[model samples]
Every structure is written in structure tokens, then in C-alpha cells.
Target: MRRFFAYLTAFIREDFNLRLYAGTAAFVAAMTAFNYAVDLEDGIIDKHRGEVLRFWLYAGLDAFMYYSVTVFWLLANRQLSILKTARFWLFSLAAIGVLAWWQDYTGYSKVVGLPVFGEIYSFAHYCFSNLSSALTVWVPFAVFYLLVDRQPSHFYGFRPDWLSLKMYGILLLLMVPLIAWASFQPSFLQTYPIYKGWGAARALHWPEWIPAVIFELCYGFDFISTELIFRGFLIIGMMQVVGRGAVLPMVAVYATVHFGKPLGETIGSVFGGYILGVLAYQSRTIWGGIAVHLGVAWLMELGAFLQSFVHSPEK
Candidate 1:
């Protein structure tokens, strides 16, 4: 295990340079081509059916290909110390391959719109989307490594306790006010949609518990992936360079990701991302942010549920 880690480290440091970034760029390009390819075949039924196949192909296959190419390129560059140890590289590749496949199959990256390349101001759009969607994770990682990791010397006054449930409690407390404010707003109930299963409840109102659970369970996959990609991987990776200040980039990326959102909501999301980015940096764990993330998703789902209750004709 020690030797394997050594090789992995070497590979990452030496071979895993801008090539990985290039591979990711390729993934973006393929996704765009596939989408446009599908769109062009709108008239023919057989061609239209290819869209679904292409969606999975470009989405799933491309992710694996990207990861594989990066790893292989790292090995070829002799960046991996113990390329002699086939077990290590194989295991690492297998794990990431599985994760990439699962994420693609679930359509996690679908919302990350095509990067507008040179076409019609596409380059700017592409840059913004990439920066917003994936680059955010690199920032927090940089900050944690620079500021937090190097500060182990001041252990006694570090205030590690603040990184506990107290922080989580504070988050919950803050959420209460936002929830209250949203609930009281007349327009709050109409802003989001809640899907109700086709049942007797369609004809009349029913307890929202079931639909809330259903929606949360279903949509939660994509939500968690977004958090993992943006908050977990990107920020964590970037922390290697920028140290603690990486949160700034994370927030910027987070805000940009929501550019398609309404101004007020987009601004609010940036604030939320900033808060989550801090927690991630402080705790050195994405799980903390994931918990907060799940909470926010639940709140959104709850808000949707309340909307149903408020808007029902029976009400």
C-alpha cells in the first residue's frame, strides 16, 4: 500500500499536468457535438432514437475515456513512481472508472450546458461553464493545503471545537430564518414545482409527506453529484495551489454556475456556496458540505411541497 501510494503520488505530480485538463476539455467538446448531433436528426424517428443512445454513449463513455487517457498519459510520462506495480494503477483506475460511469449513467452532467466555443460568443460561455461547474473544487483544496495543513504548529489555540456540531447547528439555525421568510412570502409557493404521483390525490389534496420523500430521493442523486463535483473534487484539488483563499474561486465558480438563474436567486446561491466552501475548508471534509447541501435540497423540496398545499384549488 505504501509503495502504491508513492507511485500514485509520483504519477500525479509528474504526468498529471494540463493533460488532464485537456482530457476534460475533450469531454466537454464531445458532449456538445453529441447534443448538436442529436438535435440535427429531429425529423427521422430512427435518427431521433439515436439521441438517447448518443446521450449515454457520449456522457458515459467519454467520462471513462477522459480518466483513462489522463492516467495512461501520466504513466507514459514516467510520472508514476512504481508503474511496476500494476495492482495499484489498476485498482485506482477501476475505482474512478466506476464512479465516472455511475455519474454519467445518472445524467449528472446534463445541466452543465454546452460550453459555447468560438461559435457566437461560445468561448466565453464555455469558459464560464467550466469555471463554474468543475473548477470550484480546486479552490478549497488549495486553501486547505496552504492555510490549514501548514498551521498544525499552533494546535493548542486552533479552536478545533468550532469545527464541530456547533458549526452545523449554526447552519441549521440560520436556515430557520430563511425558511420562515420564504414561507411567508405569497410568491414563494408558486416559484417551484412539486410532482405528485398520479393517484386519488390528483383529484384532491393529500399529505405531502410521500411526494416530498419521492422527490427528494429521486432528485437527490443529481444534487449530491453537483455538490461532489463542484464542492468536493474541484475545491479540494485547487487547495493544493491557492491555500485557504481558494474559497474565493469556489464561490466565484459556484455563482457562475447559477448564471442562468434569476438574479436574486443566483446571488443567494453564491452566498450559500461561500458558506459551504468555508465549512469544507475548515473541516477538511466534503461530507460536511454534503450534509448542508442535502439540507438545502430538502428545504427546496419542502418549499415545493408547501407550494402544492397553498396552490391547491381545495385550499
Candidate 2:
């Protein structure tokens, strides 16, 4: 047991730069506080109260925990630059659009708002949904560029363009089963069918070409934003101090960011983020990961757009 504890302690220290005793204590304290806030009284009168409290507790816990981890990783690695340059922001937006489209197509539009809201609320929600999803990519991208700013000179310069091509071929071959499984996972939440209103109710449902074009544009923003935040900022930032070992924190944080996702996508993201981080780190260029990321993302978005069109009774 002593040896086991030692091993566990060493693992956190090595993987997350976490000092075992203090980190363990901190985690326990946080969890205890979270649980206390979410506890329910065993009576009917408090049922709704309990549920609302639980919801808020979980939400707060998630946000706080994520922030804590990022802070911990940054401090351990000693990243001085918290904000990145303009070039990074530009690239990040491009990446977010591509990625967001891909996830949408893969039926990962779980982030979407419910279709039932009063006109003003719905209009505001729709505007925010598109706008927020479109712009939120900067968060992670800024983090990544800062983290990688101090990387050693020899970290980059590997070129296997042919290898990348071959790997993509393999991915294409495998994507058939992968996509099928991803698309059909059951959701308890029922999604609204495509509504064809213009502007306010502007149904994103119209000629496939028209909506597709608009979606593609929106998606470009969405995908790049996401990538910039996760792949570019969060992952890259952690890598500075963690070195190649940074993949540990990178995957953990990436998966958590998708905590809003369904189980399958969340699970998929853990593995996917790991692979993308490794590829990005190895190539010393985000290009390889970008290509793969963009390719998969676009395919997913296109699929979702088409499915909504085909399945919409109104259309």
C-alpha cells in the first residue's frame, strides 16, 4: 500500500506537476464542498430546490475545476504569456469553423439550444448561440500559442507529407464505421426539427445550397474557434512545461471542455484530442492536426446539414 501510494503520488507529479499530498487534499476539499452544495433533503417540499441546487452546484464545480486545472498547469510550466498574438487568433478562428462544422455533421449539435422559446428569448438565444459558438474559439487558441511560445528549437521540422497522405487514406477507410456509430448514439434530449424561418425565425432550412453556404460560413468560425481554444491554446499551453508529457493534461482538459457532450462524443474527444496533440507536438506544426481536424469536421457538418434537410417534414 505504501508503494502504491508512492507510485500514485509520482504519477501526478510527473504527469501534472502536482505535488501529491497537497493536490490530493485540495481535490478532496473541492469535492466535499461541491457535494455539500448539491445535497438534498429527504422530503417532497425540497425536491425542486434540491434539483436546482444540484444543477448549479455541478455547473459551478465544473467551471471552477477546469479553471483550477488550467491555472495549475500554467503555474507548473511557468508560462509568462497568457495572451497570444494576432496571427494566432486569425488561425484559430479558421480552425474553429472547420472543427465546429465537422462535429455538427457527426450529430454533435448537442450544444444547440432547444427550439422552444418565446420570440424575444429565442431570437436572443439564436443570436447568442451563433455568435458565441462562432467566437468562443479564441479562448483556447490564445492559451495554446502562449504555452508553445518558448518551445525548444529542435521540437519541429519533421515532414512526412507522404505519411500524412497515407494516414488520411486509412482514416477515410475507417471513417465509414466510425461515423455510423457516432451518428446514431441515442440521446434522451429530443432535438427540434429544422425550422425554415428567415432572420429571426429564418429557418436555416431552405435550398440546401443556401443554408449549406451559410452554415459553412458559420461553421468555419465555429470550428476554428474551438480548435484555437482546445488544440491551439489549452493543449499547447500545457505542453510548454510538461514537454512531450503535456499530452496528459491536454487530453484531460480537452475532454472536460466537451463535458457538455453526450457520452460517446466525450469519450471520443479524450482519445481524439490525445492523437491530435501528439501529432501537433511532433510535427511542431498545427498543420497536420489541422488538416485531419478540418477534414473530419467538415464531413460531420455537411452530414448534419444534409440530415436536417432530409428529415425535416416542413422542408
Candidate 3:
């Protein structure tokens, strides 16, 4: 317990800027509330199949929100000149747009012959889709290290945590029952295993193992991206800018990202983000956050699968 408190104390002791943190949090909160309102409006409308103009519009808006919040704090710190930041944003957005578009292009245009559902093409698409978002966020960071920043990636705090495995294991074990019990909740069950849409899993024309394998890989990738962005990039990358204050706004944005997920999860994410952020700040690594995230995520997947396997009716 003494060790745990000490670890937390170090996390809080960093050279924090409270004003910057508060301003960033307010920006995220307002934007998130706006997004939620838009989402509610979108939910009420019925659209034709394959008509995703609304979806694209919302995605673009969300991207803009992310960019706004990101640049606000970076500007507050005055680390980079205006021209450099402009250049960074231009490259970063373009890369992400290309990756997002490439998913559709590769799935539709490049696959030999017409892409059929539940076939090899679909499986390839699913697997790559998992990795695409991770790569989109990762590329700029990598480029920054190699070309611009020139510091080791560890400067962004990707090293092994001082309390990595031990802390993660303890949290994982503690979360076991709460996560399992939530799995049985109607709201939770509905949103969980959000990877259900691949449909290839049930298309018996394909080998049974193919969809499962792709799904598991995608599942792992989703959490990896989540950790890298929220815990690694947001907290550590911004640490020099806002110091320990970075963690708060990161927590705000992190929790808001889960706004469309289950209510329990959205609420849980706020607490979980804080805990993981503290660990990342103290240990100088997001590895522990990744471990905790993956463990809890996989456990929820297993729990949801088991309930369905046992034919438990939704509560």
C-alpha cells in the first residue's frame, strides 16, 4: 500500500499546468456534448442502405474536434512555431484520410474480381481494418521521432512500466467479477463484442477458423490503438506541454470517446482512464495501461460469448 501511494504521489508531482488542463478539458467537454447531440439527431433519421453521408459528416466533425483540442494545448506550450504545427497537421490529417479511404478502395477496387461477402476478401478487409486506425495514429508519431523530434520513442513514454505487470494483474483480477456481471446487463450485452458485424464468422462457405482468427486479431488491434492513442500519445506526448495536467484532459477525451459505448462503460472509462493515466505518468510507460485494457477487454468478450453459448436470455 505504501508503494502504491508513493507511485501515485510521483504521478501527481510533475510540473503541472492547471489552467491549460482546464481549458483543454472544457474544449473536449463542449465538443463531446455537441457530438452527442448530433448523434442523437442522427439516430432518429432513417437512411437508405449504403447512404452514409451522415456518417462521413460526423467522422469529419469528430476529426476536427480532435485536431482542435490537440493543437490548443500544443499552441499553449509554444513548443513549435506556427508553420511547423501547420505542416504537422497537414501531413497527419492527410495520412489519416488516406488510410480511411484506402480501406474502402482496397476492399472494393483492388481485390481481384468482385469482393464477395464472407470470402477471402472480406476476411482480409476485416484484418486490415483493425490495424488501419492504429497505423493512422502511429505514423505521425513515428515520423515525428524519426524526422522532426529525433528523440527516442521512449521520450513519448513507451517503455516498460516500473509497476507494469504486477499492477495490471491486480487490476485485472479485481475487475473480473464486475466485468462479468456487467456482461449480463442488457445495455452491456448489446454493445459488447462490438466486433460482431464481420458476419463472415457465420458464413459457412468460408472456413470457420478464418473469421475467428481475423476477429481476434482485430480485437487485439482495437485495444492496442486505444492504449497507444489515449494513454501513450495523449498523456506522454503532451506531458512536456502540460506536465501532469496532461492526464486530466486526456482522461476527459478518453472518456468522451466512449460516449457512444454502453453507459456503464462510458462511466467506467472516466475512472479507468484516470487510473491508467496515473500509472502511465508515474511509471513513464503505457505498457501497464495496455495490459489492463487488453485483459479487461478479452475478459468481457469471453463473458459475452459464454452467456450466449449458454443461451442466457437478455435481461
Q: Which ranges in model 2 have alpha carbons more than 4 Å from their true place?
A: 1-169, 181-208, 304-315
Of the pair 1 and 3, which is ahead by TM-score? 3
lDDT string, candidate 3, 1-315, tens digits: 455567777665553457766776677567556646766323532232234554454345445555565566556666445436454455345433433332222332243234453354555565666666645657756775577655555846678655566867787898899988888888777767655545565655566666776677777876777777777766676554456545665666565556555455666776678778887877778777778778887888778877776774754
Q: How close is every model to the real structure, measured as TM-score?
A: 0.46, 0.50, 0.69
**Off by more than 4 A, model 1:** 1-163, 196-212
Candidate 3 at 134: error in angstroms? 4.6
Candidates ranked, most accurate by lDDT first: 3, 1, 2
RMSD after CA superposition, every candidate: 15.2, 11.4, 5.4
By lDDT, the best candidate is: 3
- Clash count, candidate 1: 17
In candidate 2, position 107 carries an lDDT of: 22
* lDDT of candidates 1 onward, in order: 0.46, 0.46, 0.62
Per-residue error for 54 in candidate 2, Å, reads: 15
Candidate 3, overall lDDT? 0.62
Q: List candidate 3 stretches off by more than 4 Å.
A: 1-4, 13-32, 40-125, 153-155, 195-210, 312-315
